[model samples]
Target chain A: MWDYSETVKEHFYNPKNAGAVAEANAVGDVGSISCGDALRLTLKVDADTEIILDAGFQTFGCGSAIASSSALTEMVKGKTLDQALEISNQDIADFLDGLPPEKMHCSVMGREALQAAVADYRGEEWVDDHEEGALVCKCFAIDDVMIRDTIKANNLTTVEEVTNYTKAGGGCSSCHEGIENILAEELAARGETFTPGAVGKKEGFVNLAEKEAAPAKLTGVKRILKIQEILEGLRPALQADGGDVELMDVEGKNIYVKLVGACSGCQMAAMTLGGVQQKMIEELGEFVKVIPESERPVEIAGA
Target chain B: MADIYLDNNATTMCDPEVVAAVQPYFSEQFGNPSSLHNFGNKVGFAIKKARKSIQTILGAEHDSEIIFTSCGSESDSTAILSALKAQPERKEIITTVVEHPAVLTLCEFLETEGYTVHYLKVDNKGRLDLDEYASLLTDQVAVVSVMWANNETGTIFPVEQMAEMADAKGVMFHTDAVQAVGKIPMNLADSKIHMLSLSGHKLHAPKGVGVLYLRRGVRFRPLLRGGHQERGRRAGTENTIGIVGLGKACDLALEHMEYENTEVAKLRDRLQEGILAAVPHSFVTGDPDNRLPNTCNIAFEYIEGEAILLLMNKQGIAASSGSACTSGSLEPSHVMKAMGIPYTAAHGTVRFSLSRYTTPEEIERVIEAVPPIVEQLRKLSPYWGDGGPIENPEEAFAPVYA
Candidate 1:
């Protein structure tokens, strides 16, 4: 069983604002039954001041999902459309003390439903469909834009974290590579490195507000030095495993490397290469493709 | 207010008598059965008695057929691996899609190792297609492993007839009878089944002990190779206490088999009928006429299962669900999905498996407790009542699996 907080259990057992809002003018629906969770938020707004007079919700999901939706409803009442829009998925989870990482998608669903409702109130067009960006996870219908946005919002660095936050790559696992690429791009844009398995050690939220204002692009010599530093950091660990790596060349986004010693003909060579690539992308805070020296194209190899 | 446990299909409370039978072995009779001393001789005789009890319950030809293992999963693993090793030429295996994870997971891993596995499908009522089973058997098939009874739906498969069919094809047949062993009667002496597996905890014995009934003349290969235990069929020191507990459980099960079919089944029927009567859009999800006597799986549409379970838990009622949310996965129970149960009902399936210890009063309390819970959750469901948010209700909620 999940280690659910007492507050979550409280909201689950006796949820607040658990019906459609009477005399409601705005309604927003997100998620689908096929996805195993869905939420519909209804709001009664004071037409003049645009204050949410009442907020109610109906959810079809697990205990955490219902609790998240309930907490969202309680948090949004009496707030203006702008103030309500400012409430992130993290705030909803905080209202319930905290949710399991796997159930973080419940809070995301709550946030999406709030956005949909507010957009409905303003008569703005809002599409819950994945048409706005390239679809990444076909199983959950999550798109690349959503995955990137979620990564930025949650400081997600791994495919598993992205799945916990957005339900992408949670099924079939065919789209994990796509999610990883999006995470790399998002991390690059933010000038933040992706650290494999760093989420477990990281605690509390990095002030998301502070993070939003501080991204600076790294380029040219600084970028190359960063890549070399990451490779240098990785050398000791590989050497300990009776394997070693040599930096052969760097061409724009591609970093070519030669595996020496036991690493070259090892059965786990691909996994070792993937780890090297992941570490490079994370440390450099940008997208950098890792190519084995043997797999380098004829033109690149000659150059 | 005592906690009402209706999750017997998952595990059972150890019977007091069985516990008493186990206690003496832990302290007084802690001899190595392999030793030749008088202490070892006494412990070895107790083990013999335990084996005889199991052999009698299964109606096997000899007590030598009973091989004690750690748990049902181990027994299942040993049986399947043994069949493949004994017939190395056959590369294919036939099993049902709705089997316990013990069998299904092993088969999935076997598939990765280049074994051809044919997963037979089940109908909406969770019944197997016999014609499909007969057609799937071929000379290349090593063994056919199907559960005697499904753990999720309590739907019993006709394993005896299926065993005969496999025997005709010169193929081995094994049944994971973990759920069916204590609940139903089985006389393997007249059957062609080469192997059967049963867990101790599923029938009021303590956990950690299980039995694998291997037919007397079957060629076998040991999964664990060390210490010549069970005449070199299995290895490792015996789980003496657990074996004694399981032996007592089987002996008691034989005594209470009639009561299980009559009294426990009546309580089950009362709970099923009461819940269906109290809630609308509710239906049962197994082969009603041909299921285990004490198991009932009901689905309450529109609402999800975890919510209902949480509420029921608040009232000191314990049960299990086939809903995706309850399972750590994103999809509902594979058993429910394979039976073509629609998403509308699949996400809300609840299983209540009773034991011989259940009372009519407890059944009445559950019957009273469930309706209000379902009513409360359905009111919170977006799909409930005149279809609140869905634009095209019929099309949106149409059966996906069917």
Candidate 2:
């Protein structure tokens, strides 16, 4: 559970200006359901002064998110559009006596919504550099620009903290390597290379996330064709060992294989299974699991 | 303030009787179970008696099979790594995609160590594909560890059947029954489960105490190497008080098992049904018939789970979620993701787990409080439409010139 500050809890419990502004000139909605947090900021601005006469927010997120939205509305109520644009996510966190690092992304949502709302007030588009940035975290629709900005703002060196701050690399973590690369690039620009310390090296997250995130929807003839190609590559070595491996059937994404001759009873057969599966994943975009026929796990005598 | 707690799956409050049972150990009975004196002997005896109670509940062949550990994660690690060490020749593991981090994270680490892990997928209702499971069990597989019941959805796995299949194939079978031991019945004596892990806190005992039930005569390797404690199966002096509390908790759970499955289950169904009837665009997750009696995981579209939970908290209602925002991870639950739950619904999924202590009044309070909360959050949601959630959350990436 999050160690939410008292101020955050207070604002979340009794959020002020939580409803949408009716007949509002400016409306800004940012984030997506996929990200698990979204905010819509509605501002009733004085047209001549460009002052935010009133601010309202409707947020779909956690406590930190509601608190951030509530705090953001309070922060921008009396500020001009230009002044409102200067309110960073950090300012929202500060207002709430600081949010848990993991909930910083909630504050980030508030800032983005505010920016979008301001852009709407000016009758202009959110012209964020995110438009040009590559999509690094597809699970959350987070772009490279979002990652870079959060990293620079928080002086973040670890992927975990980056996820906390920006929600990039938070889902399906297949983008961990991508996040690591961006973190390094951002740090390098600041003349600060991440000192790969205990925490950084301990998780070794890149391989696992990348591997687990393998495409999960390959099927039909395409799946069979890919599995067959992988089997062909693995055939020669098995043949040399007086053993042969063949793809027998494809059920959904599961590839049924039969090991003929020596390979059927070989001690290193598990290694072969791993090899076949790994090769299939590497070549076929990782949607198939190789299930060998005519094999049962080693039986043990019950005590 | 009237508080209602329905997140028992996350952690249960210690039963007063169990707390009383452990109180003495913190003060007067502070002697080490490893000490030679009379005081120590008394503590050791209590620990032994607690083990017997748990053994009785689990229906294990012997009390000796129970080895106390610090937490469920330690027990899981001990069971898995020990199997790998015992069968160094077999380098593969078969598990489910919906396993808790205790198993999944360890399996991920095992992958880096050159171990092959087959994560069996679950269907939309969170039921494991047993045919896929059976196919993955091979001579090269070291062990198959699946959860007795999924914590997020309370969906029970066919552990008894799965264990038998693994046992027939000469593979070790382990089950992380942390969420199942107290919520469901078990008769390990008639089953083929080689090892099982249970957490103290999940069953109304205090945290920091867990159990690893290793079938007697199974190949074993100690995870922690230190003083000859837990018969050398685990190192470090025993957490005597916690063990006693756990034993007492098991006894309490056994005593209340009927109540848990009857009245508490009725309350859960009522809450689930009430919310579903009142709240629009909501549906339950998991196989309804096969789920644990005290658990109901429901997904409310458009509104984020964290936001709903926060509002509930304001109303003094405590619950949990499989939502990405609540997990401190940008991605929603791995369980939901594995089940192929749509993004709009998955983001709003909340888990309400009842306990034997839950009351009908509390259930009524939650039912009354939830509908309005969901309706309120949905009003603010950008995705909520006249019918349900809007499909496209955002437009595809496009350049925005300043």
Candidate 3:
């Protein structure tokens, strides 16, 4: 449900190097104090040849952490120190098919620890966190300028949308609410009106994301006969109630709608959601289960 | 989606029989249980019958001991508050470390209000350290309330012996039997415990109703003050539907009481064994013995519990996890932590609790679904390879061929 990249699902369902090694040459441990992922890796190296015969990992973390650990153990074994250094975080992520940009950091940790162990083996003071730092991923990495640009380009729609599109503050979350403040600052600089919801969970995160991502395209709908037409026609009515309805993609009978502004906090939102919107949507010939778009699947962070 | 109900420890399905019992109150026979007229008398008879039925279950000495409450939380608050009220001058109470939040947080609140509360520690197996508990008990202690069994781990505490200790000193004893009632054999008359709380929802009864057992002559004050209901011991309009459902649930439980321990235990043990055998790095948490007949807490080392629950949910298997969200702190289960379970295993704790409804087929589905998920998560771990990414999955899979 967490918009996991199919790659994460694959790795999670088939993690490698699960058990403890019979004997390990070097064991490395690393984790973040903020995120609750703590990892302990074991290595079994042939003493005479100084080549890793077998390696295993034991992690106390999430899917990405476990898969990254398992994937890395298989990547580096039997390789010489120099060859192992060539294996980057990107390479580790790619090996597991690919990690969600938010979860790329888990793979990065695997890369760093792997490189660090190799460094320790070669008697070099190298840390792996720095290996993939140069790669400027506009979507995931923390390069302030890229973030500012992404937020600016996405428009002053909603803070929640910026998170979905750009993966800002997605990794090692503790910065998401802070990311919203940063968005507000950027909007203020541009002389754009940016007011966050006064209270309650975001009126609707899924629609907020859909709205931001499909800004230009949402207006120019090719098919006018579907539920989208009802959403477009009913927008003015919802606005009159001090609320706005945003369409979250309709896949058959399940129509997701977000209640913005005063409508979100209104006790009548549930009835309006089911009775008004659901009935109208059904009249448009769809079995309407008007789920609150905010409550729908918008990956906040790892559970 | 298949929304199978399996988290009995969390809450159970409202039994159809219990639902039928309360249907009359919701529809035709609706009336207050305390009116002077025939309608009131009829409802009052229903309330009394429900109380007597629960009394028989607890083997209570007095039917007056069973007081219907709003829920388990209210029952807990009433018990602790009564202990404090009895000895307003004294400011000490004692409880175990793993008591449910209903009891634990109330003790915390009491401690904040100048009440000296002693928390009895538990060992690695979640067994109560009675010596540590005894050391804290003194004449100044007004009461001692420990849970009969923990909610997350299903580790049964030695409350009966602890009750005897409290009784010797004229101190009151209470137990939050929220998770233990149907699973364990609890008889208040035979035991030294004076007060016990059981939420209807924990059994097959509906929510909004609970019972607090007060031994005869135990001094206490009403928590809710209003018109006289519950003999003025608790003063609120009786939750008529809830009372009826709870009464019926107690009757069904009594009928099925003989096989509850053995049948539920067998299913739980099957689940525990199958999970351990299937998953490579996973092992069961809590003591193998001295555990609940229907609960197994297993730590699938290196993964988050919430993620596992989400995954299990996708597979249509309902279960519980002792994750960071459950604890107010970002840390894992406090019970698991008190047992000295390392953070590695602690984060991955999942509780597969069974009931009379559980079957071996469900256990088989769990075993089939879990291992591959664990294996998959491990493949993505940063700890897997120290030097770089893993390349040779075939060689890794070679052992399977062998």
Best by lDDT: 1
B59-116, model 3: which lDDT tens digit per residue? 8988899999999989999998998887887789998778888988788877757998
For each candidate, what TM-score against the reference? 0.77, 0.74, 0.63
Interface RMSD over true interface Cα atoms for each candidate:
5.5, 5.4, 11.3
The digit string of per-residue lDDT tens for model 1 on A95-152 reads 9998875677789788888888888889997765432344677656677778888888
In model 2 chain A, where is the ten-residue run with the lowest total lDDT? A200-209
Q: Which is the winner by lDDT between candidate 2 and candidate 3?
A: 2
Model 1 off-target regions past 4 Å? A129-303, B386-402
- Candidate 1 local lDDT, B1-402, one digit each (tens): 898999999999999999988887987999988889977888898899999999988999999999999999999999999989988988999999999999999999899678999999999999999999999999999899999998988999999999999999889999999999989989999999999999999999999999999999888999999989998988999999999899999999999999999999989999999999988789999899999998999998888888889899989999999987776566788998998987768889999999999988889999999988988887787777563325554354332111
Write down the RMSD of all candidates, one decimal each: 11.5, 20.2, 13.4
User: What is the C-alpha lDDT profile of model 2 across B1-402, one tens digit per residue?
Assistant: 579999999899999999899988987888888899988989999999999999998999999999999999999999999999989999999998999999999999799689999999999999988899889989999999999999999999999999999999999999999999988889999999999999999999999999999999888889888888889889898998889999999999999888888888899999999999998889999989998999999999867888788888878999998887776676889998999998778888999999988888888888899998987777666565445555654442111221
Candidate 2 C-alpha lDDT tens digits along A84-190:
88988888889999877567777877888888888887878775432325567765567777788778886777786676557666555788877887877788898
State model 3's lDDT: 0.72
Could you arrange the candidates by DockQ from highest to lowest?
1, 2, 3
Docking quality level of the chain pair in candidate 1: acceptable
DockQ of each: 0.23, 0.23, 0.08
Docking quality band of candidate 3, CAPRI definitions: incorrect
